[model samples]
Target: MRDLVAAFGGELPGCDTPGLLGWLDAFSDEHWNFRGRLGGAERDRVRVELPPRLAAAGLAAAAALGLAGSGEPAHREYTHLLILGGLARSCLQRADHAARLAGALRVGGIAALGSLRPLSAEERALPGLGRCRTEADALAAGVRAAFGGRAVPVLVAPPGDPAAHRANTADTYEFWAAGAHPGPGDRILVVTSPIYVPFQHCDAIRILGLRYRCGIDTVGFDPRLAHPPQPGGAAAADRCLQEIRSAIRAARALLAAVG
Candidate 1:
């Protein structure tokens, strides 16, 4: 963890877990959250040109933190399987992973949650989702393609402020939890890309797990196992850095909520 902190120009404070999370979040927000504005640009869409040493450090840190997919959940049964939405290709990849897990695990139901953010022209033209217009639509289409006619619930949340930003992970999780109302004994498994697992997992814990008193386990789609094969390069390292910043912020939120 300390190595990861140093990799991103952060210093791990000598403190308990909560204090460390707060420090990391503060540092990340000040130094690493690089988006121009709320929805004006996205973390993944940002083009990065990192120094070779920095890129290598970022990738190593990500792997140490399990941001490079664990490939399996901790348990074989879950009351709900939630696939978090993202970029067009990521939506399909994560949905495919979720479907594979659902087949082998005892899952009660499945839900793909996304925001109402409008899809870009490039995203709309993606295969298997040519007719889709929004992130939610992409996720729903992915589920359809991966599950092969299986009926799965798709939830979409309007942006908190349409003029500023798109609906985020918290909004989607809140929307689903409020509707599904999982019990204390139930467990939910969340699926997304490896880079996003840390932050999204923390978000799920803050919203669904804490509020509904249900267990939440978040995992990522293994890039090595992806059907079309996820491309690799320095860009992946940059994305991991972005998501590590995201995780720092979300961890702070989770700690505050726990308090």
Candidate 2:
């Protein structure tokens, strides 16, 4: 895999973030962080088959396993910009969907953002922010800045818990969405790291979609797992590996059922 990735553009591959960065070091493109997004036609196929399989999985998504790797709150935002900028733009090309997103943003559209941890100094200093500290601040600021008079994004973290974990944020979005959105046609775009997307979708559909009459679309923050190890332990690395593995198992099962 490393050799293939490095050979993609004739760059050297190490592992994880290093490999991605090494490729980028020799890479040139319109997009600096061009890690490809996951869960498209293939994901859709699995999704179509997944609902039926859920009953058998016992809701643990034991049906799905093998997935992980997301950076700090700020890193997530950075990744999101690379992925959604391209994706949302493509969806906008469709006049009907574009109009829907615009109208929804103005009235019924809700961009429900998951909670984030505190921003790093580097994150704060990133091109357009002033002094963003918390994940909510960064996301809220980012949403407003990006959509600008188009839509208002909300931080759906549980009260008193600004830094909710992945599992918790999955559920919180549904709660907030239920309140902020009521129109049957209301549109929701859930934003998070790519790895967390599947889990987020399952949680949202099971909780929010089942209860509310609305449309939901998700985009990964970024496609590459490029975050290097933190100071001490390999906890983050382990988690990312686990998540990848989990997503694969589930995705494979779902796809298999389709076949």
Best by lDDT: 1
Model 1 backbone overlap count: 0
Q: Mark the regions of model 1 whose C-alpha exceeds 4 Å error after superposition.
A: 7-10, 15-19, 36-40, 161-164, 232-235
Q: What lDDT tens digits, residue by residue, belong to model 2 across residues 149-192? A: 75554544554444533214434654565556544654555544
Model 1 CA lDDT for position 56: 85
Worst lDDT 10-window in candidate 1: 31-40
After superposition, candidate 2 runs with Cα above 4 Å error: 1-107, 159-167, 181-187, 213-215, 221-240, 245-259
Each model's TM-score, in the order given? Answer: 0.90, 0.42
Per-residue lDDT of 206 in model 1: 93
lDDT at 177, model 1: 79
Q: Model 1: per-residue lDDT, tens digit, 1-259?
A: 6775676676788999887777777776665565643443765566667788777887888888878865579998999999988877788888899999999999998999898777888777777778889888888888888999799878887665657467889988888877888889999999988778889999999998888899989988777887445755413776777778888888888888998
lDDT of 1 at 19: 79
Error of 2 at 112 (Å): 3.7
Q: How well does candidate 2 score on lDDT at residue 193? A: 46
